[model samples]
Target: MIKKLLLGLLALLLCATAYLLLWPVPIQAQVWVAPPAPGYVGPHAPNTRLAGLQMISLGAEEGPEHVAMGPDGWLYTAVGSGKLLRMKPDGSELAVWAQTGGRVLGFDFDAQGRMIAADAMRGLLAISPSGEVSLLTDHVGDSPILYADAVVVAQSGEMFFTDASTRFGAKALGSTFEASVLDILEQSSTGRVLAYNPATRQTRLMAQGLSFANGIALSSDQSQLFVAETGRYRVWRISTAATGLDVRQASPQAQVLLDNLPGYPDNLMRGLNGKIWMGLVKPRNPKIDNMAGKPWLRELTLRLPRSTWPVPKAYGHVVAFSEQGQILADLQDPSGAYPEATAVTETPERLYVHSLHAPALGWRPNDLK
Candidate 1:
C-alpha cells in the first residue's frame, strides 16, 4: 500500500512539473513589428562595380566597435579590446594611436584634431594626435557613466556622446543583457547624454531620463542632436541650445525616428549623402521583448551566459535612412565582413565599418567616386 501511495505521489509531481513548464505567465507585451518592406539591399556581389559598397579589415583580435575620420584623411577605429588603430584609404594600417585599457566604443576628431573617445570603462577621454590621453568626466551630476557608447564632434568642437546604460557598463554588458529589465522592474531612469567643452575641460549632463541611450548624431545644420535609446527602441532629438540641466527641464521632447526596427540599433552616423546610417547590433527577439514586462523572467534570463542565451546572431548590417526617416539602402556582410558591426562612418573616398566581436575594420572604397 505504501508503494502504491508513493507511485501516485510521483505521478502527481510529474504532472505538476509539466503544467508549470507549459503554462503561460502574464508578462508585459511590447512587440516591434517589422517594416512593411526593407528599403535597401545587402552588400553588392563580389567583382561587382563596388561603387556603393566597401569593407576594410582593422586587423584587431576582438572587434572594432566604432570609426571616425580625421581631418588628415586617416580613418580611425576603436577596437573594443582597448586598442585604437588608424588605416589609410587603401586599407593599409597606419599605426596604433592609443590604448585606453578598456573597451573603446565611439570616436571623433575635434576641430583642433584632438580625438575624443567614449570608453565604456574610462568614461570620456581626449587623445591628442600624438597619443596623449586625458580623462574628462567619470560621472554626470552624481551618477557615474556606466556605458559610454558613441561620441560626435560639433562645429564648435563640443563633444557629445551617449552613456548607453547606468546600471551596466560596456565591458560586462551585452545587447542580449538587458538593463531595462531591471530599471523598468525597479522604476528608474539611469541613461543620459553628456557633453564636454574643450575650452572649459569640464563635462556636464546635457540630458537625462534616457532609457539606454546608445548612439548619437548631430544634425547636418548642427542645430540639433539625435540620440538612440536602445531599450525603448527609438531615437530622441535635443536642441543644441536647450535649457536648464535639470533632468525634467533638460528633457528634449523625443520624436520617434523609426519604430519597430527588425533589430536593435547600436551607433548612428550622419553620412555625406545627408542620410543617417544606423548599425543594427543584433536582431531583437520576441521572447526577450516580452520578458521586459516581467521582472522574474528578466532576472532569470540575465543570469544565463550570453553565449548560451537564446539571442539573435550578430549578422553585420548597415541601414541608410533618408532625412525624412525612410530607409534608402541596406548593406550586409557580403565578404563575410565583420561578424557583428556596431558602427559606420562614411568618408569622401570610402565607407568605414566597426565590428563588435572581431578586431578589424571593414572598408569598401568608393570605386565610383
Candidate 2:
C-alpha cells in the first residue's frame, strides 16, 4: 500500500509540472528586465491625506476611471457602466450625459466643444454637447485602435491618444482589467501612441513599443506630449511632431521624464499654475519585479488563479508635479479607503478624486499649497 501511494504522488507531481509548463494561455511571455522598485519613501512617503475624503455615491454604477471639467463648468465623468455622467461642481444634480455602449477610459473636449473620448471597447469617439455620439476613427490604417486610452486635444485641433495594448484589445479580451494583467504579464510592449487630424481625416502612429501606454497629456505650449507607461513604471515626454518613432529604441526626441516610479502611474491632468497631477493606481509589487528576469516564472505565475497572482495591493496615491519633473505634492491613504485613485481633477473649490472601482467619487478641498 505504501509503495502504491508513493507512485500516485509522483504521477500527480508530474501532471502538475506539465500543466504549468504546457498550459495554453493567451499571453505569449516576453523577456524584459524590470528595474528595481523603489518602495514609497522620501518624496513618495506614505500619508493619510486620502483617507477620509467626502464621496458622492454612484448607486450601482461605479468606477469613475476619468473625470474632466467641461467648458460649461460642469463635472463630467465616465463610469464603468458606459454612461457618461454630468454633475454640478459640488457633486449634485447627477444626470446622464450620454452612453457609449462601451467603456470610455478617458476623454477631452475639442475646440468645437465636442467631447472626444478614448473608448476602450469602441475606439475613439466624438460626442457633441447635445449627446450625439460619433465614431471618430476606429482604425489607424489596417490596424485597429486596440485600447484607446487617455486622450488630449491639441490647440491645432489634432487629437493624440494612447493605445494601451495591441495584443489584448478590450473587445477581444472582454475586460480592460483582464487585458491589462495579461499584457503586463506578457511584457510584450505592443502599446503605441497615435495622432488624428479631424480636417484631413487621417490617423498616424507617433510612437510604439511601450509596455502599456496609459495616460496622455500635452505640454503647456502644446509642443510636447507626456505619456504614462504603466507596466514599466515611468512617464515619457514625446514630441507632437514625432512620427513612426520607436520609443523603446531610445528615440532622442522621446525622453523619460521620470524613471523608477514607486507605483504604476495612471491618469494625468493639468492643475493650477503649471502643475500636472498624476495618480498611482497601485504601489509596486516586489515579487512581480523580482520575476521580471524570469520569463518562465511569469508564465507559470499566470497559470495560477488570478486571485493568487502577485498584483500589488491597492494604495490610494496621487501626486502633483511640474513641467520639469519636480514633485509638488504627494497624497496617500495607506488604509485604501478609496481604491484605485486613478486621477485628480483640480478646481478652485475642490480637488475631485477619480477611481477605478470605488462606489463613489471622492473629493477634498483644493487646499494644497
Q: Which regions of candidate 2 fall more than 4 Å away from where they truly are?
A: none
Candidate 2 local lDDT, 1-369, one digit each (tens): 999999999999999999999998888788888887778788887789878999887766799999999988889999988899998888888999999989999999998899999999989999999999999899989999989999999999999999999999888888998888888889999899999999999999999989999998889999999999999999999999999999978777899998899999989998888889999999999999988888899889878988888878878999988888899999999988899998899988889998999999999998976
lDDT, candidate 1, 190-238, per-residue tens? 6787887878877777777666677889988887788876665556677
Say which candidate scores most in TM-score.
2
Give, for candidate 1, the lowest lDDT window spanning 10 residues.
43-52
> How much is the lDDT of residue 312 in candidate 2?
88
Instruction: Give candidate 2's TM-score.
Output: 0.98
After superposition, candidate 1 runs with Cα above 4 Å error: 1-57, 171-189, 243-252, 303-308, 333-337, 367-369
- Assess each prediction's global lDDT (C-alpha) against the native: 0.66, 0.91
